[model samples]
Target chain A: MESQIPRSKSQLPIPDYQSSNSATLKVDRVTKRYGSGATEVTAVQEVSLTVAAGEIVLIRGPSGSGKTTLLSMLGALLKPTEGTIRLDGTTLSELAENRLPDIRLRQFGFIFQDFNLLSALTALENVALVAALAGAKGKEARKRAAGLMTDLGLKERLNFLPEKLSGGEKQRVAIARALVNDPAIILADEPTANLDSKIGHEIMRLLRRIAKEQNRSVVIVSHDQRIKDIADRVLWLEDGQFKEMVTMATDPVCGMAVEREKAAAQLELDGVTYYFCSRGCRAEFEAERRGQVVGDRLTLQVGRP
Target chain B: MILVAFRNLFQNKIRLVISVGGVALALLLILALDAVFSGVEQQVTAYIDYSGADVFVSQEGVRNMHMASSALSASVASKVKAVSGVASVTPILYVTNVVVADEERNLAYIIGLPPNAAMGGPWRVVAGERIPSDGEAIIDAGVAEKSGIGLGDEVKILGEEFTVAGLSDGTATLINSVAFISKRDFAKLRGDPGTVSYLLVKVEPGGSPERVAARIEAQVSEVTAQTRPAFAAQERRVIKDMSTDVIAIMNLTGFLIGMAVMALTVYTATLSRRAEYGVLKALGARNGHLYRTVLAQALISVALGFGLGLAFTLLLAAIVPQLGTNLSLLISGASLVKVSLVSLVIAAFSAILPIRQIAGLDPAMVFRGK
Candidate 1:
């Protein structure tokens, strides 16, 4: 079989943010371990990366690949066992426990797969609550929250509760909440996992636009390949170790990366060959090409780590 | 943050109802228990409190009229009236006896009074006329209502028949109801016309009752004298000695039950919202913010529950007496404030478990999608 791994680290297409003039987040040789002795488990191992301002970095892996663990450490929600994480030139690992929350409040915004909005609050209130915790109060927080919601095309649904909003609309509100604080970096975990293809791609587009327009760094951990095109760089992990990073084509139907050498099926369209991860993906792609309306195939698997 | 906390409480309608209802029920139990005890205490001292006398002269060594027997010559009234600062003196007899009404026997405290005395008689007459002639008696309205007997009814006391001439309001105690009879009838029943139980005294204008009481004690031999308030305080002490332990046990039971209900309801509500709390922590909410949120929810429930419980107690106070129960509910401002303080303390205590959960919550759980 042809080697699926890229030949050299230089050919991986990873953005050289280390040499860039403006790096917003820097992770150096980070490792996270749980338990010890005979019951030891390493969730993440010796990973280093840098994300520059206005760049979007996507981290992809299968289940149990420590993507969530790595994301947690980057977001300052958890401490790295063996390395340092820096955000905007400040070393997060050296900060006191009490000051970490202040750092997270002012410098980082997080989006989760579950759209973790408080169900009791209206969309506007949910977005405004973050700003309120950061010391903005009353009308000021509401005004900022309203502007973000309107910018996200959710102005009409601002007063609706989370239960009253649709899945796609809820993700939009979550995105609005994350951007409400105007943080230096945005950390997202499987943000599009709960949305349909069109809606997921829409959320990905919103994140991409947020990075470019606001000049904020975004780091996403996801399994969905549809958003890979929007990323300036991509990192892959397997078995708690960094694997070869590959820039490959994505199956348009199923949103899975497809290496051309090991393609399950391929077809030429408009003089360009598209590779697929599965026969079903090829058939779905062909059906779409033949003007068939394939219903959304986004099936949510809840409680995934 | 407070608005979000309040909104979280009302998010689930059923949960809100159950939580608030639990607290309300607990508060109702506590307040109702306290009010009942207060009503009992008020009733226990009603006779002395309503007498409008300045001093009471009992036999020497007598502390309270209800607890011990005291006897003095009826002529002591004259000796007491001659003391300086004495305006008037009336001799009265008090005895506990069984009265048969409608063929049902009930215990009562029978007081013998002079025909024209201004002190030591029913203060407020709710029905019929006051005790007029010999062999006529005045019954308390509580006893009349409880025993299904009213004015114009005949009753038997000490094997002698007497007409129910009038009714009095709030003249009954937990141990015995008040029944007023003429001194002639009481003398006949006692086989001695010159003996009395105690002498009720009124001081002249410009004279202090405390001073007059002290003078009476100095001037009268083999007799004890007390101001009206001192006499009432003695009666209250006797009642407390008899029933304080039981009432205290009941009050403690009420407090514990209320605390438990409040703790459980708040715990369940907090547990259900633990995920949302984790999300808040992930969004940079401090432990203080989360603590305030939980405490706010608990306090809101407590306040609403207190209002409901007070309303329920007032309703019971209106309805329970009509249902023919001896339990009296007395709602007072002091008791209301006391119960409110208790409910707040319980609410604050109930927030402990939820606050701990939120404090130890890992913001990383949000990334884990659980």
Candidate 2:
């Protein structure tokens, strides 16, 4: 889900928030088919998307809907049977097999649903190993890994093994690993599914902050609907293709999906307006934001329209 | 990749022990069988090796005494004694027969000794006499002990009874035991009054046995002379040629079993951690790295098992003598080299299946659930 895709508030086309930055990852109508003759299985079909720098695209879908296949093709882990996947300007599908590994190492980072930390290595070493794989010196890799872990709030848990760490810490370590190589794009598959709600949101927010601050592209695929608030653009996929996605505005009160014209209450916070599903939610928002920095145009309206 | 391979190999302590034990046991089977053959080779040639002769003159074209007829005219010994480098000559009659004692009998090499012989007598008589007198015998100590015969005991040889006069050492092996009797009695029993089976000659100080042997061949008629080492080597070869096929079959069986054990061990370790290997591949590790991991693991196991097997063989060599039997376990250089080569082959063979498995592995398996 690139920012330049045709997503709008009222079916009216609007400029992308990050149209100024170039696309780091681009997939042009890629199709992946397995087997042949009667046993042909089309796991992914004609999926096209472009992700600009610092853009966070969350692909949400039901199970077995080709979310993983699309993510795999985007990450260059699997070659598409048709069409092309390009990182910056190089088409990954046309490269030699020997060249794909270094591209995967230095160009695209991967975060798995299960964290997938090597059980034998410590948390710090797990992140450092990725840097070393990209040809960083040992001392430099360790230092980089240490800094990433500390920045991710895992300073004291660096020496713990994956089995010894909590679910949240493991995912954070995985995030650090995905970022350790400083790749142009990060492909995360169900990264927050194993985590609880509070920790899951924190991880999503951390991912958003990292993508924005580092100008790195992030594409997350998950079934968890609760993470839509943190995503800049949430694209829906079904049956090996993308449907017209809902540009939803989440109601913080009851965590309901509140579209722009379907809000019961609205509170403008800073430049962006926050829509509430009810007057009680808007009142709670106002009491919570008393004496806080409110937006200049604090539009307080309570109506169904 | 090396670190992961090591962790995978050593992850299960019990399995590691089983793997090491399998290799060690396989190595033991091989080294022990080879060492037994080596000991037999040494024991079969004990008489020739310990006999105090610098040169041996036998019937023409006879190089070894075992299972061969070597009869020279009695005058050949005299002519050999006349050779320039000959210090002394002792002629002995040799025959292969059995010694019997009260329903118990075993094969024996019944040797004939001359009276006051200089070289042709029991070289190591641990008891009464080196050369037997008439109507008396010198018996191997090991054979005597096993047969419950003592000094002064009467044993039947060639259907005649002779009292045991001395007990000798290094004269018995699994194949046969050496028993000594006087040349007069041997000639009487054989009824061949003027024949010598062999002539043992000692060279003077500062003389070459090979040169003396060549001179004796030139001077003596109807006889062949060989230096002591050449003759001893021939005797050992005689034994080796007889047992090579059987020992070779046994060694080959042991080596194959060793390879199978090592292969099974390395393959099991690789299989148990197969997902981790897939993960490594998915992480952009080349197949060369994974192959090296497997090969290194197999070779390490072989090296450890080889060291363990060698220690056990040396311990067997040390403890075998205390059992007080004629069975000796001689760990020779040839046996060590043979086992070392066997180990290298075992390691290489063991790594084959695992490397193939890794080479064909699809990295997509890492994304799939079990």
Candidate 3:
């Protein structure tokens, strides 16, 4: 099978910001585990990737495939159970807990699905707050925030509160806030989840422009396929590890995306194969389709990693 | 950070008002109760405080007048008068007993004084004469008004009838009032030939009452001499000891309710903005910075409440007496200090739960949450 690890073929230039030690993210076989003993659960297993300045890497995976865990570890919000995560020159795991906040402030920018702007502050103040936290005095913080918002075409809505802004406008403000502090990388979690398709694609284009022009690396964890063409590299994650190739199937019972080969259960009905992420989903589907399921084929297998 | 903290409040104006109002009412409860307590103390020591005597000579082992009996020999009074720096000594007979007028009974400290006594009678005779002759009584004007007994009304003291000849000001309290009668009638009724309850001593000009008291104690036998202020302090202490637990429980209840109101207000305020706090945490605001912001909010609430409560207390102090209740309330500097400290504690502890909520907040929520 041809490898599905796709890279952008737009002939767009990826500017290198190595001159500023602030712009590189390296993950070395990072693993995240929750619980211990009999309850031990691995969320992400030895996933390694390097994000370079001006490069946009989009990690797409099935539900519960540890995309968020990887993003969190990459952003210094969570420490990996094993292996190393280095951003620029600093190893995040080796830094004291108190030191992580400043590093996150100066090195990472985060855009969220909900827009997460403080509802009390105006759109401009929302962006200015991050700069202020990094010790930018008020006038300077506001000036920098205004400059970024103006660049994002939100100059007229600077004083409008988040509630007063539209979904598209709020996302633009969020993008401005993310770029306000000139962070080395922007980590966005499902940034388009709350927007209409048009606005979502618009935000994607904006993020792409930001990456190239600012020479900033962006790590976006999103399941929205419409934004895929904007990423420099797309990695398909299955069972917490990068998969070279996989076909995703929807679980009929739970609406979860599952890789067909690794599903917990499968049945062929009407010459169509149905995949389920868990035994519970399969059992529930069978019960619901009692009269209709004189199944042509049925299979149960140990779930794959 | 301060502006952010203020913005936290401005976003929830109703909650801000509720929080400030709750704390203000609580502090008002405490301050109003404390004012009554202060007034009681001042009233309890009124006679001793206002008496012209610089020193008091009581029987040894009797340190205060309230609920205490002192029987000093007449000879001790003579020696107190003769002590160096002693200008004059007026020996008075006193007893706490019931006084009845027109079938209305009231408790009174009935004092017996000699005719033309130097300073033992009511200091301010608001209505009638200063020293009452035999069978004539000087009663507190407040008690007279409350009992419906005016000057010249017949009153009974220790089973002896006396005509009310005078009305004294500021000598009535919640517990009892002071009434003055003649020493001859007191000695006649009691059949005690040569005993005085206390010697009211006046020191010569420029003489230190403390030194005079010391000299009197040295020169006189079987007597404990104390300066007027010292004696008044003991009297106040004796009364305060009787009511400490009652006042303490009241003040503590008010403080706890006030603190809880403050805590609840601050907690809800913090919880209402939990998402924003998450955003701040995710944006790299440290726990220390967030804690300070929340704490500043708490302090602002308490400080505003304190100012409001104090104003209400002073307003009451200015207006309540006109309404004609014996409960005279006033605020003191020392009480302000105490309440200020309590207000500060309210501010500090009010932030604890909110800080915990912030401390446990995950910056990851900005990514995972809405």
Candidate 4:
């Protein structure tokens, strides 16, 4: 009975661009304005991007560079002042507002840099909420979220609130929440910006791994160059215009790439192999490697370059 | 997300408490006023119902039973009794006179009931017995208690003397606090033995009160036969007219104050949590989700306030005896339901502008702290 099943192309779990050719997201020449006349200012101007299935794209920009704006357009959170956003081949501009929440709930998952977790909910509850919103029953969602958190190494912190969690732990919880729906596209805005360099790399690795393993697109808005290498493709934006696109490479230590000649930190410990992104990170790694007693994993400050 | 909504409300305990307290106080005032107004109305209608007369025959244009200016001579009753379907008619004499006794005297209405007249006699007596003879009086417990009078005590009224022989409850000239004397004594006190005030007429069981009233008015010249219910309606209209301007101003002021409090509560709650709402929206919460979230919070606050106000109204009536027997604080089912509906509508309506702010948030600016 183990080998009796015949796998059909439709039954396969692989991501297919031809079948999902509906273009999960498209933002074309989107522009936005606030206020009027003398007081008016443009926030997002003439921005366009498209995210297809099975693609991990990074929207890179500094503060006020409108990377968040472009991500919002893709997520259907905002209506472009001049252009349209198409999700799964349907232009969002033409959709009625009453149907917006339904589209967002069923089609997209959002992750934020600040880890915008409702402080009142526990970590497990937060992830469970997204699952339930995506149509899983409450109890089933909670059980699945618990299993996902445990797999993400957050078993001991399941019931803890966001306020009680560390920067890295909170981002991991957000990641778990974003993946709860197995959405076609995951929109993340600076998901790793709040964590330290070491923890930041861990989060990027998780996002990239999910992008490849689960075959779902994760479009992130970030100024953190540390995550530039892990992305499948890096999209550069300056003043709301797409500058260029570059291929990414994997970091040696964590097997996650950092673009623009970035490297994961490395450490030499008791004749064992380890890696770090910079000398300071390597020293910190060495200190932790030596200071640790038998069973516990040691932690130290590995500052971002 | 609604679960997140509930969590957010509970997170802001101080704001919630203030909102709830303000709402409760407003509700209390509304309920208290309604209760008193309702109680007064009930007390008036109850008196009319228990009077057992289908039609009250008074001088034309008379407004109420106890007004000094609204009197008719005793001859009107005999004339009214002769009208068709009129089973019995009794003359009821009402006049205000000063009572003098042991250096303690006060102005009190002296009501006279005709002998062997079922239509004009004390319906309920709380002490001693009904007036037995001429020169004897049945005193209202309210006046007896206030005037320090008892059975066998003698009092001189309008140059005529009488001894208190019984006490009656629910009998008064002004707001149920008058003295009852024999019709003979009343005539003597008023220095007029040939006249009385208004007639109370009982119609045959099968007769229509309105038809009998019309016939009596037609047959008896210069007299009006008011069916009891219609008369009660007129009484309310008269009282409302007297206090119309003041009550109107009071109600308008109360309504504005209630709206202002509700608006401020909703506004403050929304403003203080603006950044939080922005963050929620950035995290993919739809505008409708945040709107419903804020609306639910307001509803819960209003509901809490309504419950508190109802309890407070009851407590006020219980603690202050003036609001107990005579001046009741009225909270009817209709009024209670109306108050809650008003609160919800106000809450829901007030939340609109704030939720628009949440909806219009630029996720980019929100994330960058711009």
Q: Count the clashes in each prediction.
A: 0, 0, 0, 23
- Give the per-residue lDDT digits (tens) of candidate 4, residues A1-305: 00011122222122212222223577778887767899976777887777766667888866676676667667776777788877766888778766766666656777777787768789999899777765689899999888888878889999998999999889888877866666677888788877898788667766766666666777988888876656767888877777777756443333434443344443334554343446554665555556765743434333345
Q: Which stretch of 10 consecutive residues in model 3 chain A shows the poorest summed lDDT?
A: A1-10
Runs of candidate 2 with Cα error greater than 4 angstroms are: A1-23, A117-165, A168-182, A197-215, A246-297, A301-305
Best by DockQ: 1
Looking at model 1, the pairs that clash are none
Tens digits of lDDT, candidate 2, A1-305 = 21222222222111113322334788899999999999999988899988888787889887888888888778767899999988777999899988877887777777888888877778998888778777888889899999878878788999998989999899999888877777778788888889998788677766665666567788988888766655666788888899856555656655444545556887776667776668887887787677575653466767674
lDDT of candidate 1 at residue A242, scale 0 to 100: 74
Interface RMSD per candidate (angstroms)? 0.7, 1.9, 1.0, 2.9
Task: Compose the digit string of candidate 3's lDDT tens values, residues A1-305.
Answer: 11122223332222222314347889999999999999998989998888888777788899889898888888888889999998877899778889999988888889988888888889999999889999999999999898778767787999998999999899889887877777899999888999998788678767776676676888888899755556666788878999964354556765544567767888766566787768888878877787675763445443543
lDDT (Cα atoms) of all candidates against the true structure: 0.81, 0.80, 0.84, 0.70
Q: Write the per-residue lDDT of candidate 4 for residues B78-109, one digit (tens) a residue.
A: 78888999998878777666666556676666
DockQ of each: 0.63, 0.33, 0.50, 0.29
Ranking by DockQ: 1, 3, 2, 4
lDDT value, residue B36 of candidate 4:
67
Candidate 2: clashing pairs of residues: none
Residue A271, model 2: Cα distance from true site in angstroms: 6.8
TM-score of each model, paired residue for residue: 0.85, 0.85, 0.83, 0.76
Question: Largest lDDT belongs to which candidate?
Answer: 3
